[model samples]
Target: MYWIKLSKIYFHGFVAAMGVIAVQGCVLSTDLPDYKATLPKMADSWSSQLEYEVERSSIVSVSQTWFTPDFHQRISGFIVEGIKNNPELKSARARLEQQIAQYEVSESAFFPKIDLSGDGSRTKSSSKGPDGERIKSYENSFKAEARISWEIDVWGRLESESQASYSSLLQRQRDVEFAQLSVATRIVLQWIELIALEKQLDIARQEKSNLTEIVERTQDRYQQGVGSILDLRLVETDLANADSTLTSKVNEHSQAVRKLELILGRYPSGKIQSAKEFPKIVTDFSAGIPSDLLVNRPDLLIAEQKVIAAHHNLNAAKANRLPRLSLTQSTSYQNRKLSDLFDPYSLVTSIAGNIIQPLYDGGQRRAVVAQNKAIEDETIAEYVNTALKAFDEVENYLGNEIHLKKQEEELSRAALMAEQGQNLSRQKYYSGLIPILDLLQAQQRFFVSKSRLINIQKQRLLSRVNLYLALGGHNTPLQKIMQTDPEFSEDNRNL
Candidate 1:
């Protein structure tokens, strides 16, 4: 009979709770908007085609064209070392991991939360009976209970939040990849700069030696009464200039080494070895279509992911302006006797449902929706800008490759002619056919042309590196270029 009565009471409580939920459901209304239609669309292709040409051709492959075998090996090693040790890349990876954890946290909202609790209490009371007699009472109670609660996502609020978090996780992952690419590109460029500086130092030393020899010869001619003191002074001044230039080049080379070492995550000891000469790279830059950049570039991909995340955020914000339903159930066993707490007769259970409809919040919910929409628009603009910038960079580097090659060729011819002229002028000065001023002019022109040619060569190599970076480091095109080059023999390895 007692068990029957307890069952009736529990059934009544459940019925009452259902009645309350049904009543509230009829009165509450949701104000959420359809957010899917608000998402922005992206372009399927580039706005413009890559129009730069090389060797009178509109299309070229840059992948291995400028990457010589030695350059490929050295830069590959540096990139590997830098990716392993760069602190900025490591930090980006750490942030990715954190976002992964946050994604899981957001996903947890889809499931119910359960809690277990237990408590024991003893109470004593003293009071006077109706007949003026003193009376005392003591009581002991023990209880154990399990409670479960869940927020029903009837309007897809939790689902939208989970999607947003997942997009954020993907964005963070792209950020890490972008960091890796950036670190590798920086290492390669710094390494190239250091090598070019070393070549400049060599050129300066050679020029210094040549000027010293010229000054000695002029002094000898002055002692023999064939050269004026003014002529000897002119040669001495040139020698001093060469010495000062050599000293500056040496300092620059040292600094370049230190910069490269820092990028490699090594101590800036300035002891790194560099190539003795600039690698002979191909003049042709193989730039495929501009559309390839959208798929290949990490930064662009990251921007796209941000837009996705923002779209999800906007959905979640719109969903927040609606009614939320939550259900909770608790069951407990209670008994004065501690061991009898687990008895079926002592059990009690109750269930409840709550619906929260925001009547007023001073327009906070509307502001949140507007803010997320604005953020989505901002990310879209940034993505479009990134794509345009990438295309501009590709065009700039391709044009640079063509113009730099022509400059290098013209300068090479000038350097050769200047060398021959300097030699002939020296011979003529010894034979008393030309003045010392003429010889000095020829020597100065030769040194300047040679120095300029070396610098142009270095610039060409640097431009190739920039093209590699702008193309998102895709190297298959480069391999094809390397295979077609006559200089790439069986012994030459691809970068």
Candidate 2:
């Protein structure tokens, strides 16, 4: 009983001494490094020419819904299905969940660890008394103990670990958002291409029908000795080429449909139907300042998160080289009878504290700190590289829109003139006023001009889609989705 009292006094003194040591460690430990110092300078305005002045808005404002009710209805349906079922997006979400679980595991380090254990043993011994008489004795013992251990984060090592995990989780969230945006953009492009192929097929079919009529008329004239064999053969050749062009267009359309189906996580059956007509693109959306990309673009945000994670990891590595304080407490009971193992009178309690300064470890801790610093630098460089690439994409797409509009206008005029020439040549050939070669050339020009016009129109639509993507357009309410979680709400507020 006197020993128990004495132990209590010693435990209190030990706690007091450890508190002083912990305070000293805190004073000697430095605060985390400024992570923002690693970032590159951001441009105030985009290098690309904008039709309107740059508008600085909230991140939510930047997520303009690109698809509207008046926009192609079938395309909207396909986008919905694709977003719900895309395998890549599903995997991204799963990774986000994994990061969440990992963050929770890292956060658990802040709490103490507890364990319970028990044991029972029986022993028998035979011995000889001083008179050489044989003596037999048996003893039974049972014991149970509960123990707890906790590490005091004097140098903020645990805080840094938790921060790293949180940053990683944020990175995964941005990845999922970017994946969703990519999938939707891909589906829209495929659907647009498929519609373009259908338009081209219509032109091919019309060309074939006109050539078929010309061939029939030439054959009749030849039978009556009015048309030469050369003329008849030339017409047949044009007819055959028209048939080949029509067949190729059909195949291209089929492939485009199958590609779209694959994006929707469906079998590539080529059975998915596209919109009857190409979706019209609204070209008037504003492209915000380049600085907005840091907040609006998910991929950019993801890169920034990587830098944050690396900074925290470096801090944790540095703190690992400092002194660590740990405390332990244990309670135990022992009795010869198992039923009395928990008796109050038989219980013992003890408390202990220790500090580990890591005096020497063959330079292992220093190497770890160096490695983390290098990693931090690598992430910073990668972030700058990613930002530069994003700027290039936006500029290129914006410049392309201007040139594409000019091309579309000129192609439309060219197609109209070629159509008129083909009609006049057909009438002249049938009236014996023009040679077969002249008519064939006119038809070829008409077909080529029409095909070019259709393709340019498709390109313009695709350009709009690309421009929207480059500007960080979102098809869903990303802010609402993020705000559903309390931690993400804080992030949004900070953004």
Candidate 3:
């Protein structure tokens, strides 16, 4: 009786402690970590990262422009269609489906299990008296019953296992989200690269055409009495240079086409057309604060979920060593004949209590417990590291944007002056005021400066895209609101 009283008191204490722990779970994580808080400020304020914020854009609303129906191409839906067709994401989603099925296997233990059973036998027996000959007898019997068993989950052991399984399922769902996000980001970047290459091809073709005209004029001058043999040689040199540049651009343009086709999940053939202009990029991305980033990023959320699952696993391992209490019961009917198998006249009932404690296992259970704990610790460390790395990316982009903006302004002025200089030199040469070398020098400088300007513009646009992605909103208004508010108010951010 005294021992019974002690056991009751012990269980009560445990239940009380668990209730306290459940409440603490909510309160302990209210504050964001230092690294998470510093990200937005490091990237500059809301206006700083808002370089590409287009006025007509809506973060939540989809524009009809992104999914216009083409008569020839069956493609529709920018991201949704991309995710549907993406093989990696499809594979991940299939895996998640498989994992969701596994949860059923673990959950089955929580409910009663039933088994049908039967037994039949025929026996020959011999009996003998102390002084008499042995006598023989025959006996036959048949019995059938339905057996049922259930392990009553006490001490939350079964609940803990279910929680662990749920965590695993959740982790896989996040993996699916991660895969989708990855494919979407790749498609966007590859598409952007393809467009940039097309523009470059145009630049190359334009330069070649201009150079051809210059070469032709020089040839006409050389053929006249006033021009030298050196002038004719210079024309030949310029023509060859233009051909070489055009060849390089053609090769690059071909490569970009192949890459874009591959991103759409197609096999690359030599066929390519620069006919399609790129979709207007989303410039205005409102990236929320650093803490908000943690919620928006699928990769980080998946990582955190994995750590949470590992934590549950470690707890499960620890629980395994404790004595588990379960109640098993079965009610059935037995009969000597098949017809009587269901008759309640021969009903039988049994209830059993099981107390299982791990006495010895060659330290295997202990090792498992220790290993799981170590794994949980490592995951926690990794979660912290990933969070820090995200912070660095946001900060780097912010700093780059500020500096690149200034550089773009200066380079624009430089390109304009170079253009003017090139025009003047061309006019002077026609009047024989400048030598062929002076015009060639000016010609090279003018194109090079113009190319540099184009290159910088491309970089700035790419920076906007990358910054938007890294900040986790991809040129959406929710991102800006998150940045300005620094609080994750967007309903979609969590998901």
Candidate 4:
């Protein structure tokens, strides 16, 4: 009786505490450590490590109108189409919804669970009395019961588990965002490549036409006895080579068109035509500080979420070794007649609290703690490696931007000179003042120079694309708001 009375008092106190918590709507009063505090130190600025002067006036993020605003706008339609149809992006969104559902499931643990049950039984029996007379008896019974069970979170274990689930949800959210960015980047690259292939095909067709005309002239000269048989053979060989080159270029152009159509989530019918011209390039942009990577990059944010989840998992594992307190209440009604089941005399009620302390579990709890710690370590390492690789990518693309520009300029001059030399050699060969070999060499040089020029120009554009991707596209409006609003910042997210 004394123990029952003591339990009642303790239960009342617990109920009062729970009432206050229910009003507050929080599982724990204290906050966990912020993820930023756990990050490794990084350089203050990106330019310090770069060889060239980077315009540091603004952080270079993915912008709608990037290095080539005109080109970006032109491709915006394609990007929109791809994002809508991309299977990977769709899958990421579905995973995000799945994570949201899972988080809700974890949160349900914080509330009481109630169950109801009903049962009815009927029996008939007959027996013989000691006096040899037959006796018969009939019996009927019914029961209805309701039970409520709640686990008290005295050690914040439930809170930690919920937090872990929430972190995973956030990770999934970031994945969706990352998928969108990736789809955009890929579409841009494939579009640029298609244009380059188209240009190359044009060059190949022109070369084939020029070689065909030369072959006709050589045949006429040879028939008129003004050119050697050897010269006619050379022209024929050149024409054949040009035909082969044109065929290869046509195949490449077709394949490029098909690849692009696929990226846009369309049928690869090899019929889509890319714009013959490239958009104007604008190269003056800034690479923001390295710290922005933590804020702007989705993969890094996902990594941070992983770390947060691992931390909570370790906490929950440790809590498993501690005592767990749970309360169960059951109310039941029983009677021979169904109508009298709920009668005051037939009613019974009971409430009990149980505290289970782990006696032994073959070191399972300790092993779980150790395992979570290892996972935490792995996430940290991966985060660091990802950051380093991001840094490297940014640096490499920036350097390529400079190098490719120089290459295009030099190749442009080389192509121009080669064109002049080839023209002069052809004229001299027609006048019989230059050997066939000299004319052939000049033509070869001209073709190679023009091809290189086209290729280098494409590379320059692609380098800029890569640079924008590496910089981690521009911050969204919500991110901008978060930057200015203290309440939305990562540090205050717990509140």
Candidate 5:
């Protein structure tokens, strides 16, 4: 009964000791700044707040869809291939894996480390005893030990480090997402450019054909003594200019195809096939608000993650200023006879605990704390700047979308009028009612107007692409953003 009572008392003592150690563990506290409240407010709705109407007959809503049917199979295939094979994206994925490994490394600090070691030796010695006798001895010794050591995270330093690594991993994940978005955007825009160039080539060939007909007519009139040599020369000059423009367009088209091929991670053979016409894209974009960008844009997400990591790192640095506690336990066996090495009588066991508090380190610990705090502040500033930049991009693209559409409309009307004027002048010239110069001027105006119209159409498509990118590329709807992850939603709420 007395032994049972003694055992109970010992158990209570062990429990009390553990309680004291747990209470002594560092309780980390942080003055995490509230940067979310400082984020500036943006317009409530892009359409209502903008200077012009974003909705037009041609403008289609892109809130639900990213790529329209007009993109075609080939362009979509190229974008997918680019995302899968792009070296930059592969590198980003590797970096994310590295961060994951680092996170696991930090997590290991929470557990104890055990080691087993053994040694054996043989020795021969000579000894003198009682100043008259000599003795010889041979000895063999064997030792084996198992030890375990652990640092009790009294101040939450290890926990903070693990959190920092997790945040870094998330940041890298956002980086990969951003890289993917960027790659896809480039592919889409380049595909559009290639199509526009093809159209320009067709337009140039038509203009050349028209100039060739005029040149033949001028030659015939000159031969019949009805047109002056000066008129024939002017016509020939116009034909030459048309031919030159056609050649330039062909070269440009070749260069564009090669550039797109390179982007697709293929050889620049200048043989890429593309759509003959520019695909119509959705022009209208609904930029929800600035706060929405906090969840939508990958770059902004990365910045926010950085701020979180910095906060954790600063906390860790502060925690480093406290005392550390370590516990060690070891069991061993040693015997002079090899056969007796495992005997119960040869066994030994010991346990020890240590507490180390920094006395002086040439102010190194304080310096680290200061540096981490400064880094935290820098990250906060960057986060704010990134948020502001995202808002500015949305605004710029919103305004450009409106203006480019208006410009496209005006240019289309001008092109129609120029075509009519050219047809009327040709008829009058054939009836000898107008001079060759008048006919040439009308043709030139029609050609220029058509070319300008095509150029503006290309710009409008590009603006739509820019608008898509500015609004965080493809999936910017609140529902989609929220579905990314619970942590993402939490982070957005924090923002």
Candidate 6:
């Protein structure tokens, strides 16, 4: 015991000396890497561009705009309303709450375990007396006691469990946040698509009106024998198609609008106002050194924490194989009558320490340790995979966004040329220089190009949303929630 105490004192002194040195070094501000300053020039440049665009971008206050205008229902804001109103998001949040509850329950293990118990009973007995006679007696007995039992976490197993649970709670919270981002991105993408469809329908309507005028002019020329019978027939066919195309496009637009509304927790209304322009985003981003990413990404951090928790769990399993020390004791005064139960003369006290070692358990304990070891291994593998996946997602989104922007520009030019062709063909046919078939061909080309353009724009917007999610967009939604939540009020104190 003396030698152990001496060794412990020596270890403590060494640790204290090291701690003092560490504190002194920390005070000196040992030239740690200037992380924010050294942030990738690409990220800084892109962030500046993004901020510029966001500042210039048309702002619509979703707060005032009814999500379902016909229904007179409006969502509060994109951040809080988005999470609370989304069912999938709510489910994820509930899981977060469960983990938090588990953390609280596990935390209780850190405190002493005590019980207060009471019981009442009646019994009848038969016994042989000195005269060989059996007798029965009735009595009511009552007992009450306060019991206290404690297992001192001398080796810190309990503390490790509590820590593991805490990490799990944090991980769950991050998961809920991630889920919120995913839902928001989906809603935004669908909204963009619906708006694109609206624009597409408008384009279709304009083309239809233009074709109707061309058709009427061609028919008049045919009546005067300036246009051929074939030309007139071809114009009639295109006129019919224009009507059909308009209806089809309108239907398509309604479908997309409905889906977006569903995501916003509403029924689709044809009258929902879509923004005239799409949100602009900057895609240029570069992740810094490999070492810099671990703390920056939440999902990666969560996976790493899980691995750490698993390792601690395995250690706890091993600790279970060793005998645990518990001290249990109780003091009580009891009698058949309540009046006598409080007597000091009737008091009883006992104290004892317990030790139980596994003699044999059909190898159950061994199997448990092995299983825990395997789980730890799996967690480590998951940690590695999750890290790699996060890195890959960021890189992929960045590259794709850059390429998609160029594609959008090219498609826009093609759509413009098609529109020009439709105009030229119409004038040529009216002058009797070309058949009506030529005009219809020009119209088809215009329709195809315009459709392609709309799709590309939608794709571009969605790509940005994907990139935002991959790069772990700022948790602005959470901040917005904090500002307005009633629970944050000073009057809502824990008391």
Best by TM-score: 4
Writing each residue's lDDT as its tens digit, candidate 3 over 325-354 gives 577677766666657667777788888877
Query: Which whole-number lDDT from 0 to 100 does residue 33 have in model 6?
Result: 23
Q: What local lDDT score does residue 383 receive in model 4, on the 0 to 100 scale?
A: 74
For residue 81, give model 5's deviation from the true position in Å: 1.8
Q: How many backbone clashes does candidate 4 have?
A: 3
Candidate 2 structure quality by residue, lDDT tens digits, 11-130: 999788667656644632234445445556756665555444334452223345444445544565666677668898789888988999999999999999999999999999999999
Q: Which stretches of candidate 3 lie over 4 Å from their true place?
A: 1-76, 118-143, 225-231, 267-286, 331-336, 474-495
Give candidate 1 regions above 4 Å deviation.
1-66, 124-139, 283-285, 475-495
TM-score of each: 0.81, 0.85, 0.74, 0.86, 0.84, 0.76
Candidates 2 and 3 compared: the better one by lDDT is: 2
Q: Please provide, for model 1 over 1-495, each residue's C-alpha lDDT reduced to its tens digit, 9 standing for 90 to 100.
A: 999999999999978865765564443223333332333443453223233433456344555355667667666667666766788877887898899899999999999999999999999999999999989999999999999999998667788789879988888877876776677778767877777778778778888888788888889989999889999998899889888999999888888888877777889998988878777774454466677787888787887778777877887787687778899999999999898999999999999998787769999998998899899888888877887788788778777777888899999999999999999999999888999899989988998898899889878878877777788766643333333444432323311
The list of candidate 5 runs beyond 4 A from truth reads 1-31, 47-49, 52-61, 65-68, 72-74, 124-138, 282-285, 337-339, 474-495
Q: How many residue pairs clash in each candidate?
A: 5, 0, 9, 3, 3, 0
Q: For candidate 5, write residues 153-197 as lDDT tens digits.
A: 878888889889999989988887787678777887898898888
Model 3 C-alpha lDDT versus the unseen true structure: 0.65
Q: How large is the C-alpha RMSD of every model relative to the true structure? A: 7.6, 5.8, 7.7, 6.5, 6.6, 9.0
Model 3 error, position 391 (Å) = 0.9
Candidate 2: stretches off by over 4 Å: 1-44, 50-69, 128-137, 474-495
The ten-residue window of minimal lDDT in model 2 covers 474-483
Candidates ranked by TM-score = 4, 2, 5, 1, 6, 3
